[model samples]
Target: MKINYLELKRVTAMHAHEIQQAVNHVVNSGWYLQGEAVGTFEAEYAKYCGAQHCVGCANGLDALTLTFRTLITLGRMGEGDEVIVPANTYIASILSVTENRLTPVLVEPRLNTFQIDDRLIEQAITPRTRAILVVNLYGRNALTDTIIRLCTKYNLQLVIDNAQGHGLSLPHGTLHSAALPSPSVVCHSFYPGKNLGALGDGGAITTDDETLATLFRTIANYGSSRKYVFDYCGRNSRLDEIQAAVLSVKLKYLDADNALRRNAAQRLIGEVSNPLITMPSAEYCHDNVFHIFPVLVKSPDTLQRHLQDHGIGTMRHYPIPPHQQACYQAWAALHLPITEQIHREEVSIPCNQTLTTEELTHIIFAMNSYDK
Candidate 1:
């Protein structure tokens, strides 16, 4: 019994008939882009996130880029404005800021929560800091109460990269974090592997501000609110009808599916009590959807190989920190020890919705069996 890291095929198979119907409907509709399907999904997703509006985009990166671009179009942010972001986040989070010509001030994460340390955010802020890009890394909320207050005290816009956290929410509500931010914008990705994944690439931006929402809609559509009337120099990025329709179907089941992932995470946290391995803190369990179950071990490579020997597939969430990447030559000398250690030690095991009880047991046993 081979246990793959994420069985996307099984995920799709879970609702194949429903998804097929939605795809067939979109195919027969003849109105692919900017159609009713996208509009309906946008509205539905906004309601789900407790936001007033949602703008669908082609992919997650563009969703983030357009949010920043919308701020820039409105004269809120501009070239070289510093946006504090997580150093341990996926490269896309950093890319979104740099792609818009905004300076990314990478902040280290709280080793316990795997979230941006709110205590450190104040130190990173300067007069030029226009926004804080808080990422919900590994489906855990980082926009805590302190970070929200910091955003208010410093008058910085709060932008969330919620690409990994589709169905996740604080116990109080989606709006309230344990100490969550009053975010100005939250971006989502429906990439095939995401919690609320579409068949292919998809993304959306949710916001309460009407002006920003309208601007995001315009910017995502090649800077046009109306046909052939360009307002800003924007690129083309749209969530097609099929992906929107598929996402709409999956959105209905997100919470239920997330529950399964959480169960798996809890089991792992409870069962894998090896002293050499460090599982994520269970403190934010209620707030997390467990998009990827990350475990830190002394030798990530050896542990990964050990799991593979047991026929259980695993992957590293990231092998390289963004700052150390070849592209950022100037920041080569900058040392972020915490982020670098996380990059080296983290291993992402199967925590998706499709794992069977037997597979889960096998994985837990394999993890506990690792001697080296």
Candidate 2:
């Protein structure tokens, strides 16, 4: 009874027939790039997310970079501007800001929720601060009401790094807009392992701002607003027809799959009563799609070895903090205790939609038995 960290094969098997049909349809269409499939998926996804527009891109990182570059093109932001981001987020979130020549102000995340501490946001804002990029880490919603108010008060752009948080919704009041209930620009990933994955790498940006949407679309397509008419010196980042077709089929089932993940996480939280392990609160579970069920333990390496001994696979969402990475040598001396602690102790367990009752119980038992 080997329980893999994520049974991607099983995930594809669940919708094999439909996925194949969609792939076949794209293959037979004779039109690949900038085709109908991509257009259709963009519209459907925008409607699903309650956004006015969606621009599909090559991958999650591209989606993020394009959003910032597009904003720069629109004169909403400029190079060297500061963008506040969580110090605990994946490197991609910080990379996007730096790639656009913007400064990334790393703020600490709250230990309990693994989200940015909104209380610390205003303190970090300087006159050069132009935006805030909140990553909904591990599929949890970081779109807090206080963050919304702060953005409005500061006249800053609100960008969402939603790569791991597909199908994650927030309460109505948490968002400012009644129509969309999301940020001005939200980026998504479909990197074969995400909650809403495609067959290959894929991503999109959702926004209600028409100007930004149009700019992103133009910028993603080699900066061409029309054929051979280059706009703002962009790159080739369009979401190909094949991945778009695959995503369209999978998007329909995202919510249902997320529900299963939530249930599995609840089971782990309820049954695993080990004193050494600290699970995220069930109260905030509903706001998360459980892309990764991370448990904080004193000895992550020892626990990972124990799970492997039991034929139970696991992973670390991130083992190194971004500030400590070799690439960011200048930030090596910066101290972010909470982020460093999370990186040291966090271990991601199997909590996908395909886990069975017996498999979940086996996990709980193994976890409870780990003392070191």
Candidate 3:
């Protein structure tokens, strides 16, 4: 009855046949990069999100990197450019800003939501402020609407990093925080684990603006619309046809799959009555797609070990915040209380869409068995 912390295959089983067919079609056609599959997937995904356009890239990291790169190409983010980022996000979001030589200002997360503490954002802004990078954390909408308003008021470019929040949305529509920014760049990662995960690494950039979309495509393909021409100093990164096809099949059932994850999360929330463990808050945002079912315990390390001993695996969402990581220790002069607090307490339980009734009960029993 052992359950692993996270299993990627449960949701993917649905699209196995269609993905194989799409791959076979690509192999026979011999046109892999920038072909019909990639184009169709991008178009379909964009339409699904209610956006005007989508540009496919090699990986999710590049999606963010390229988004910033496009901003650099447009003369938006330069050496002195300051980009505000939440301290609780994944490192890729921070890398994109730093790789472009822009200064990244870390902000704390809100107490309950684990989202960027909007109160701190205005204080972090400076004369060099260029943009605000809003991340959709925990597969829930995290202060995106508020961030957009702040960006607008502050005259900053609203960059949307939607790596974990695919298929998530706001009250307005299907787009996951896409409508907020004027020259906004929404980046998604299909890293075989996300709601819209590809077979391997894949990502995309979304924008309603035509010029930015055109620029992103060129930047991702070694700065050339026509091969080997070298329009700008770009690198080679393009989504292959195989992964695109797989993503398309997965995309069709993303919402339904998310609903299943949510159902699983609800089951855990209902049965677990332990006083020491704080259950994950149910989201009000309809766009919420449960990527991780994390609960806060008094001691994360002790609880993780306890679950493992009971044949139920658990993991910490993040052991360290971005600023506290070894590489980013140089920026340790600044302090962020809330982000650091989240790192110490959060633990993701064994949650996957495929867990059967028996497996789920086992998982619950394992967690409930852990003592203070």
* Candidate 2 weakest lDDT stretch, 10 residues: 173-182
Off by over 4 Å in 2: 173-176, 179-183
Give candidate 1 misplaced runs (Cα > 4 Å): 176-183
Q: Backbone clashes per model, in order?
A: 5, 0, 1
Q: Name the better of 1 and 3 by TM-score.
A: 1
Give the clashing pairs for model 2: none
Q: Where does candidate 3 stray beyond 4 Å?
A: 176-179, 283-286
Best by lDDT: 2
The true-versus-predicted C-alpha distance at residue 275 of model 3, in Å, is 1.4
Local error of candidate 1 at 57, Å? 0.3
Candidate 3 residue-wise lDDT at 125 = 90
CA error at residue 8 for candidate 2, angstroms: 1.1
lDDT of 2 by residue, 1-372 (tens): 799999899999989999999999989988999999999999999888877788999999999998999888888889899999999989999989989999999999989889999989999999999898999999998878788887888888999999999987778722224633234799998899999998889999988888889888988888889997996677899899999998999999998999999999999998999889998876557689999999999889899999998889999979999999997898999999999999989999999988999999999999999988
What are the C-alpha RMSDs, in order, of all predicted structures? 1.6, 1.6, 1.8
